[model samples]
Target: MTTIYLVRHGQTYFNRYNRMQGWSDSPLTENGVKDAKRVGEVFKNIKFAYAASSDANRARNTAQIILDYNLANPPKLVEIPNFRECFYGYFEGMNSPETWLLTAHQAGYRTFNDLVTNFDLDYAKDLMHQADPFHEAETADQYWQRLDKAFEFLAKQVSFTSSDPVLLVTHGTTIRSIVGRYSSEKQFDLTDPPRNGSITTIEMNQNRQIKVKDYNKLKI
Candidate 1:
């Protein structure tokens, strides 16, 4: 079996402002740095064999900070661009969550409340499709494909037979995609997105069947 630790990057200015970050590359907030340090402390005793993170600076910084705190001698850090947040296209930097919600409703989507009340695969796909009519944004399928590829790449790079744990630090969307792939679920709960500085763990058998041992443990 292989143990995989998936961590979401710390909070950012965009996160606090409720913006559509996508590939915006915002710097971490002061609170974010503090949160990252706390996350590092939480895993201070755990040693990982390999560490990987999204190419985004937020994720990369989080991985480095965690390693600096935890491992006496950190393993090599690999950058994986595939583990990035879902691209929001032209909507990037937008902070109008309410406008988006209204747009979804106008498009005949179940109301935002209804969508939240009934978060399922069909609902998720509909939201993605309705959100970006021009197809400039990443579709649900594209998001899942990137996540699936990242996991397959990780599995190939790591020694499944070894006991050492592998760490993956990435964005909330990327992490959600990972969970969706493993669970084979079509619709994802809005709550499924991990908060900044949160960690989730999964255990996988040799056959590559994954079991989510823990989900969304936040480090304050």
Candidate 2:
């Protein structure tokens, strides 16, 4: 069995402001840095075979902190852009959730809760289409395809053995996407999203079947 540690990147100013960060590349706050250090200390004993992070700085910084604390000579930190947060399209950097609701309402759509709770991919696709009427960003299909490719690449890159563990530092949405692909849960809970600096542990057998051992559980 191979154990994968999926760590959500630490808090950011965007997080505190209730903004849709998406691909904006926000930096971690001071609290975020401290949380990352604590997370590193908590996982100091485990030696990861390889550490992977999203291309975003938040994720890269978190991965670096963890590796720096644990290993004298850590494995190379690979940046995978495809594993980025969901593309919020026109809503990027928008701090007003109410504004998003208004835009969606005018576009014949309900709130994000409606799409996320109903697991309505069609609604999500429509929202993406309507968000960028001029089409500055990728379509929903394109985003999904990108995530699929990222997962394939990571799986191929990490030749995991029973003795080795893989660490992935990424965004909450990216982690949710991966979980949705394997798990039976159709919709994520909107009321309580994954907490910052939390870890979700997953175990995969030789047949590549996944078992979620823990979710949103932080050692520190």
* lDDT against the true structure, each candidate: 0.74, 0.74
Please provide, for model 1 over 108-192, each residue's C-alpha lDDT reduced to its tens digit, 9 standing for 90 to 100.
Answer: 5544445544554335544655666665766677767776787777777888878988888888766665665566344435455
TM-scores for all candidates? 0.86, 0.85
Candidate 1 Cα lDDT to native:
0.74
Question: Which candidate ranks first by lDDT, i.e. highest?
Answer: 1
TM-score result, candidate 2: 0.85
* Runs with alpha carbons beyond 4 Å of true place in candidate 2: 71-73, 103-110, 120-122, 186-191, 204-211
Cα RMSD (Å) between model 1 and the true structure? 3.0
